[model samples]
Target chain A: MSHEELDQLRAKLDDKNMELLKLLNERGNLVKKIGEVKSKAGTKRFDPVRERKMLDLIAEENEGPFETTTLQHLFKQVFKASLELMGEDEQKTLLV
Target chain B: MSHEELDQLRAKLDDKNMELLKLLNERGNLVKKIGEVKSKAGTKRFDPVRERKMLDLIAEENEGPFETTTLQHLFKQVFKASLELMGEDEQKTLLV
Candidate 1:
């Protein structure tokens, strides 16, 4: 491919990457809000039933170019991490 | 209080703490299993609606000296960490 074409493709890739980052950041903020509510309510930090439900929801919701299974696995991890950022008690409980 | 009585109380406390640890570990193992299933299934993790449901369940079930809200917050944190141990993709997605 021509150098100009290559450069244009690279720019497009960069833009998509940025979009992903922005979406992730938005998710993080929402999760953080959850954590705050949880903490203030003096509640326990983990809920497995909910986590399982999430997977089911994604399976239901995905209109996939990617495999359904792939999306489920990927989002499972995403939700997990978002939980980490959101909950301090979870961090302590796991470590202990 | 006598020294011997104090020592006995200390041992009781230790025993209770150990029991709590054991229960937490058992929960951890179960969550890890959930993680594995989610990964294989290609599912998303984290369900706020489910989390709310859990708190409601706890409230309904508790015969409490401690408040229902307190238990909910604490368990929420626990579930979050279990997710971290289980899912790799989530870790990457969050960091980026």
Candidate 2:
């Protein structure tokens, strides 16, 4: 590939990165809302059943060169990050 | 919050999940192209300097309920998944 092709690909990747960042923040907003609801209801923050279902759903939908295990692992990280975000908000609310 | 509010929040989360999935696949496509370029150039697959720059950029941009460390860890997983996809493709190309 030429220099131009490489630069174009990198530019595309950067665009995708920005999109991911925006989507993650959007997800974080939803997580905070859900956390508040769960806190009010006296429910647990982490739902193992829902997590499993999400992994299963992703696996089913994946038309991947990526393995199911890799998708599961990556999604697990994403899930954990969202949970941590929600957990931190709950802690702050408790302290206030 | 009421049942209706919870349902709305959950619906929004589902949409975000789908968006994330699409973005991830889009990133994967770029990774594959970059991988091919790197293979031809005999360059390293893992670029620690570039990775650190990305993490720093994310931390700077983060208006987070999540800490920088958490972002770093989560992004490392995302990076790993992309690298794995690229590596697998490289292996297939080698075999052919």
Candidate 3:
């Protein structure tokens, strides 16, 4: 393959990265909204049962060049970040 | 707000998570293809310059409910996973 082919592939990879970034942010926003609702209802922010269910669903639906374990691990990072983001939003609401 | 509202939000979050999962797998496939090309051309798999550029672009584009730092951290996890995945592909190729 030519050098040009490699460049094209890299460009596509970069585009995919940006798409993933956008979805991450979208997920963050939804998590923040859920956090607000939970706070109002006096429910705990971290529901282990719900988290497990989500992870299980991910494992089931994963059709991957990535291993199921690998995808789960990466997703756990996103899940953790969303939890932290919820904490940040809760704090912001407290200050407001 | 009713319990139904919270359920709706959680459903949306789940949808987003699945979408992210699909995208991640799609990215994994692309990375695998790129790995094959790199192997063919006898080029190094890990390009720090390219990785740095992608991170910089992500940082620039972040309009986050999650902080930029948080998103960057998450993306870095993904980038690292992709690199490791490429390594795995290279090994498989070698075994063939």
Candidate 4:
């Protein structure tokens, strides 16, 4: 590719990466909200049933190059991170 | 502060942040290993009991500006991330 074309391609790639990061952060925020709901309900922070439903929804909705398994893995990490933020108090009390 | 001093301080801060990231990643890997052991033994993936023990150890070992609760929060996030990576397979099967 020409120099200008190469630069344009690099810029596009950077934009895509930035978009991914933005989406990830947004998802993280949502997870935190979910954690708040669960905690306030005096429910267990980790809900395997809800998580299963989430993965199934994603799998059903996905039109993807990525497999359901991969999506599940990525989102699981995201969900866990959210839960940690929500469970800060419990971590100290329960763990210590 | 002099420009030189400011630059040096910024560099130190960045270095410290990098060090923190490195330690976090190292801990993440260890958690994954722990998860493997837990799964093989049919132990529960999320261990609140062990986490509390960890916080206590850190608190006892700490001579620090950061409070025990703060450490607990940060490390809890790290541990959750590690669990997510380790539990990828279960996420799909269990969640779906």
Candidate topping TM-score: 3
- Candidate 4, residues B15-82, lDDT tens digits: the string is 43333333434444445555555665676877677567655665665443334464456455555555
Error (Å) of candidate 2 at residue A85 is 1.8
State residue B87's C-alpha deviation in candidate 2, in Å: 1.5
- For lDDT, candidate 2 versus 3, the one ahead is 3
The Cα error of candidate 3 at residue A86, in Å, is: 1.1
Off by over 4 Å in 2: none
Any residue pairs clashing in model 3, and if so which?
Answer: none
Worst 10 residues of 2 chain B by lDDT: B63-72
Cα lDDT of candidate 2 equals: 0.80
| Candidate 2 lDDT over residue span B1-96, tens digit each | 466787788788877877777778878878888988888888888989978877887888777666778767877888998998888888888899
The C-alpha TM-scores of every prediction are 0.43, 0.92, 0.96, 0.45
Q: lDDT tens string, model 1, B1-96?
A: 334443454354334333333344444445554544555566555657755655565566554333445445555555565555556545655699
Tens digits of per-residue lDDT, candidate 2, A35-77, equal 8888788879899987787788888777666677877787788
Chain A TM-scores, per candidate, are 0.74, 0.93, 0.94, 0.71
Query: What lDDT would candidate 4 get against the real structure?
Result: 0.52
The candidate 3 chain B region of ten consecutive residues with least summed lDDT is: B65-74
CAPRI grade, predicted model 1:
incorrect
lDDT of 3 at B94: 80
Which 10-residue window in model 4 chain A sums to the lowest lDDT?
A13-22
Q: Indicate the residue-level lDDT of A92 in model 4.
A: 60
Segments in model 4 whose C-alpha atoms lie over 4 Å from true places: A1-96, B89-96
